[model samples]
Target: MSRLTDLIAQAKERDLELGRELEREFKVLSARRSFGLNFERHRPENVELPGRPLRKGDKVRVLPPRGSTTKGDQRLWKVLRIESENGMRLARLELIGVADPESASVAVDDLVVVAEFRDYIYPGLVSTGKVERGGDKPFHTVINGENFYALEALTYTHRGRIDAIYIDPPYNSGASDWKYNNNYVGEDDLYRHSKWLAFMERRLLVARQLLKPSGALIVTIDEHEVRRLGLLLEQTLEGFTIQQVTIVINPKGVTQGYLSRVEEYAFFCFGPECKIYPGDDDLLTSKDSTTSDDGYSRPRWKGLLRSGDEAERKDREQMFYPIWINPKTKRILKAGKYLPLGEEPDFNVKDEEGNVAVWPVRKDLTLGRWGIGVYTFNDLVKKGYVSLGAYDKKRKSWGLSYLSEQLRKEIDEGTLVVLGRDPNTGVADVVYEGAATRKVRTVWHRTSHDAGAYGTDLVGKLLGNGRAFPFPKSLYAVEDALRIIIRGKPDAVVLDFFSGSGTTAHAVMRLNRQDGGRRQSICVTNNEVRSSEQYALKAENLRPGDEEWERHGICEYITKPRIAAAITGRTPDDQVIDGDYKFTDTFPIADGFEENAEFFTLTYETPVSVSHNRAFARIAPLLWMRAGSKGRRIETLPDEGWEVVDTYGLLVNLDKSAAFCQAVGSNGTIGIVYIVTDDDRRFQSVVRHLPDAVEPVRLYESYLNNFRFSMGR
Candidate 1:
């Protein structure tokens, strides 16, 4: 009867009556409950600390008044979401306005985390060393979540580090598949397409950063989201070229056809220099082959070629111009038998006055560009090649192989080759048709993925506790795409913020193990569950302990755990996971950045601020090279601009990390160590790594003297 009871019934199909009775007795009776408000833009009112930067998994106090700097213990709030623009980052917090808790969809400016996750804490703690090492394969992991914000945070926080990304983001199929905060987005909803498009737009904009230039991204989307996703990738990867593709998941659509319809669509977003998987070339057995009379091998071409129009096929009798006679027709043909070139008996030659005349006969003739293959008159031919045909004594002729030699000798000796063969056999240099006309279409070709039961397993295995997330994905399907894109690339990271059941993680690990490589993957996804509209907390609840909550943390539960478990079976004691995985959700992050990415300023924007704990720290060290430096910095050093920032080096606002050495400068060459937060220790380290930076500078107390050694003020 009730929604909660219905969910219980759905979870336990056979015991529906029992579930309904249990739910009736235990279900909360409060009727005033609803999903959280999904806000598109940030509101000004419901925020307290307007400048505090929000990172992943932060629980900040909410619903406070705008100006009140609530000092005591009341400023506690949960950072439900995070967003970024060209550079400015914002935090989406659930604020309970002092006057009314209903107006809680306000956003505030985020403050940079001087210290985030300093202590490595995870529910499932696995000692990797404790687990026996069978093979040094790529560790697999899975993270599950219920919403997009959580997915974005896990993936965005560590962008460049990811190797390959695969995700089955919401289909937005005008069905319940599209849920913003908690409300179900129907498939036929008028704004379904628009809502889905907007949702994907933000995710892709951030997802692009996670890819290494050579890294590949495979997105599984239905026909509805296919076109919009194409545009989204183009907008995000500005200079990059996107190779659009159509994976016919099903020929069968809502409407039926003469044939069985089967095919789904998938898109691979990559930089200009991306590679596709070549598949198992060794497994390609050329069943069909051709050979000359003397046993020389001839090229065999397969597949349907529909070069002729309907008119040509309609008049079939016209093409039957009588077969050329062969004296050795009765002779036993070679295993790889091929017919010799026939004379030009069928072609009509135009005379001087345009009078039609029989074409001249050549013992050996080719169709040239107009026809498909060569046909030679047999009177002068030899075993497999076209010989003198009783015309010349020292003549040698094969097919293409002979043609190549003749052309080479003719070009070198400056001799005109007219002895039954012309040096310039082709009228034009270009040959063949379109570049990709050779490969067949993707109709029946099943990529080892989509066809298997893996997708079904994905849904049934993890989220089958209640309402199963339907048709998650087969690991092979995404893996096939990965193999197509990145062959044997050893150094590539993967990302997928919309991970459904961690197929991408499985693909990455499987591929690396297959190729003995070391490719990594990063996935992001939200926890999904069916709940009733009784309480706001109940509608969108995510906290510690629940398996659903852990599963929603895909990096911890799904991606990483799966990988670790495959290496070491199931965790026994710890509640982190049931499988034996020496799983620790702790990833490496220090106060300083790796300085791996080269930074450049496109506009005369405010530069990054640098501070240090040691003396002699300055802003100039980010750009210029210095001795005794292991770290490096990259920044666009502007000579002049509208507003001056740090002049010594380019200044960049701190985004993810707490502290790092950087050369900060803005237009007009004004530079200084921009202190994002007042943490002097982090600021001190920023000064110490100056030697590691491409540029090095000594910090002074002021424009005057008193320089500190690797220290900043």
Candidate 2:
């Protein structure tokens, strides 16, 4: 074996040994698990609190039996121990700070986790009453809530339908950029990496279930956690092709300590059969200034000599040949015979002055092959597809160039093309067809992707003078990344769980406006109050959880307002800021998008128990979202809370089941109806009255099966 191959094998063996040693050490520490990473940490299950089995140390407010205690007699107690008696869990409690008080036993149901009842409520949407011009278009959604729970709610509606997901998650740079459970996790925290990993793992697992089999997930991160996030994604999303692309967001790098970091990473994890769609932005094209007699620039020239792998005569011996040419005019005359290795052929071509001309060969007389074989070269030459360049004294030979007939014809036809011009000579060096496009490279350094100009300045202009978000991504960069994946699939559904400033939604709307496609975006972000906002709110004695503080969060005050401004062609202050959009250069800045979007804040459903009868009302918005959030639900008596989508109606109230079915039967397009009734017999009876083309489905049954959770007794 070659020395390099041997060295690689030895390195591989050493790596295997190191891996085994690490495995053995982990096994010795009892950290090895069967299927996944084992951190050897205890994490309690997130359950509905205040009922069923209660753990020790839980606080309780005790009330006397019906007639024994007055309204003012109740006192708070703390659970000391929990034990099972007669198949019932009981808690031993002691009154707080009561001197010499005897401990009392009570049923586990009497005790509740502190402030846990408020969590039992389901999340609901509070519309901000702001929608843009296109009321008839599919509504792009910006959900204001904790993404974990928001994603859980979306599972009920958008499962397996999302076409692409682009998320710019926190880099965990220890800069107080992100918060976990309402508290910022700093760099010095012991479980910082673990917490971030766990947080992303949970969300990514859910996000995976939401992607179509042909969809892709694009995630952006910095060097701080790129490797960790990559491993986490590989472990969580197995059997997928994952590629990491380096994007130069900052050309002038940000200096940390020694090195200036200019690049971040994007991890693209795609399902089988998913391929990136090349965009026209980076395509090679001709310039307008370089016009020839035919109104098009001269065709570009390519070196006829092959250089890499197969350039040597031994690789493809038949490609080694000569072409007879006039020395002065630099025009091809005829083909010459091919010479085998260690053989030489004399070229005795004479110019008009009778001077013997030399063939185009390397200075050292090495036999290099042409780019194509003899027959291909002959065909190209016959079709005027070859160009002979001026002789070079230093190289001791003339340079042969090749041109395709299609390119020549395009040049003659005056097609708009991209031409590379020389600064000194003012000569067009090469020309390319305008229609030609190329795949985007891993490294993107386009000026349009500048975060400072496009992200901060543009967003600042839209939201007001002050910076609305810190280090927001460039809209054009996000749009370009998305366009690469969803170009042909224009009607695709996009999702961004960590939609910081709702840039993804804006890009989607802009894309739809550009292509007249009906693409929709679902953006989920928590209305977490930033530190700056918190300080401002503190001046007014308003803290988190206060109505005023909640209204001024990142989602409500920034994300939603920015989206509204982009759609309405005005700034947040109502000033018209309309013009040509700088990014994409295809749409007007203030064109007032012919698209529509809704702003919603997630709130919880009251009364913890979501019963079958009330389930429809609780999940009606979810059904509307599933139906593409097109038209509003009909809430009158004859309709009585029915959501219609084309010919399909989601029957929420079946009070007048027969009348609803009869009305649906009159409409020939109403082929399918989802009736929300718990009774199977009633559902079957309702189906009996439906039209022949219409099919009946039980909405409540499916809802219950999809969203079954533990409710404390």
Candidate 3:
């Protein structure tokens, strides 16, 4: 068994054993009446308040006490107990499940219940510019906010639609690359790995829900967290086929203590039907090729004689055949059918020297077969698809060659012509015509995949400024990975939660342009400033929330600007950098690319006491986005625009229910109709009047349940 499988089996066995032991211990304690020995510690306490009473199992937000050392680390906490201390109510709080070091206690007022893990409503996407080559609507999106909330919002619009996900999350390298709860996590942090795992686990849980059945998730990481991340993915994404691919991002290794690290890893977790598209064959250019035409070199040749087990006649007796050729002209004449053992086929033609031609059989006379069938060989010869190699005079044989249909077409069209003929066999050496495609390998070593060369330098040129984001991924590398997953799926939706520098989205756009596809991308990234940048800003007397500090953050200055520059072929300052990139050149960065993008910031609706009664207005945008964001919105009730329901149908006024239904039935082509009413009678009344074409769905109840936080008021 593989090491990972063996480890999983061992872990299961250990858990089973541990469970049995715990059960036996519990029985012994029950028989000896010792289960109740810790009765004082298990005593329950009741604390009453003016509003909703505090209870166990409720999720709450814990605010640090006035003079505590760990102040301002307000995080989601669970209420463990509620007791009275010195006539004042004190609630015990724990961080999710971890016990507080000092048995943290907070006043009843400070123990606020979490109303919502994230906002039920999100802001509309504001279009910055258009990337013209894409479809009428923008095919790419960038959300500048916390990824967790962004992913949650995506679940409403893109669930079960995204075909691939590529993310380069923080490696947790203890180099201040990431932060937890607004504080940078460093080497000395005790729960660094645990925190990272928890963060990934929650986001991945939501991310998994957003994938189609034939979708894949690709995550890039360094050595510091590869194994742990792999294990975490295995545990969380159960039943997924997980694979690890080693990527050589940095050729010149980064020096550490003893070893210089050069390689990182990409973890691919896919569903059952997920198939990778083998990229074009031009990627497999041989080292000896001289000139490349249109980003591809000449097609390399392979031997026609079949090798390995399949070469034996027993594997397929029909494939065992002979190919005939003219002795002087070296042109293929005919291919002979299958012959039994010890049987020789007759040839009609003879050599110019009056020598009878020989069949292409092994000297040992073993029953070996040709790579293709006899009929296939005949068809290839008829189309001049065969080439000849140097003659083996001692063995009285000549090497046979087969050309692909692409090569044959190229030769026929005169685009690829016969340069010369072989001196010995008189076979023509033809120039290759079109670019061929081949399957991508697991290990990538192309110069275009280099991080520093393509990512840093190319982005620097596009931005027309020297301020480069730290360790951005190579755009070509991301494109190649995505191309493999989204090869045949042109209209597939792609998502990236950790969309640093917006490379994934940029790659998606490039791939769409190359293939004339309409694939879309949704990128989610936070606006937090990097630790290095933050320190430098602080040294310059700029604080975290200051306008200057916020303006230079990763999401604001880096990711958005980079994507804008890439699409428009210009820097943020409108300086043109849209032409071909001179650094390690290939394709034009801005040619044929549309400058289309929508910038959105996730925010909570005002007056955040979001109960079922007042959630309709807050969740309208969420429902609109869920309906593909394809229609116009009807702001006021009884408006003339209500005559047309473009994408989504919403009804808030019960008095105009009949008119709304009549308008929808007459002129609307909506997919779903959301009816808002506190009374079931009114809901059913509206539903009964709606047409059968539109799906009638009741809002508020499910919305409240979905968005309500498990916290005390």
Q: Which candidate is the best by TM-score?
A: 2
Clashes of each: 135, 14, 13
Model 1 TM: 0.43
Task: Assess every candidate by TM-score.
Answer: 0.43, 0.65, 0.63
Better of 1 and 2 by lDDT: 2
Candidates' C-alpha lDDT: 0.38, 0.68, 0.66
Q: Write the per-residue lDDT of candidate 3 for residues 39-118, one digit (tens) a residue.
A: 11111111111123466655566544433334345456667888899999988877752333345688876664543333
TM-score, model 2 to reference: 0.65
Assess the local accuracy of residue 711 in candidate 2 as a C-alpha lDDT between 0 and 100. 25
Best by lDDT: 2
lDDT of 1: 0.38
TM-score rank, highest first? 2, 3, 1
1-713, model 2: which lDDT tens digit per residue? 22233344555566977656655664565644565553322121122122223446655655333222232223456789988999998889888634456578887654544322213335445565558578667789888766776777777677888899999998898877886533477898776787677668778888988888889999999998997888888887887899888877788999988999887888989877687786654422321123355433343466787776666677777777777665545556556667777776565555466544334465466666777767877776665567667777765667877754445555676552436543432233444354344445566767767788888877887787574688889888899889988988878999999998989998898788777888999999977778755655666755445577677878877898889888888887788874467745555577767788887766544332344344334455565677676656432222455545554676667676766776787766565678866688988887888877776668656655554552210
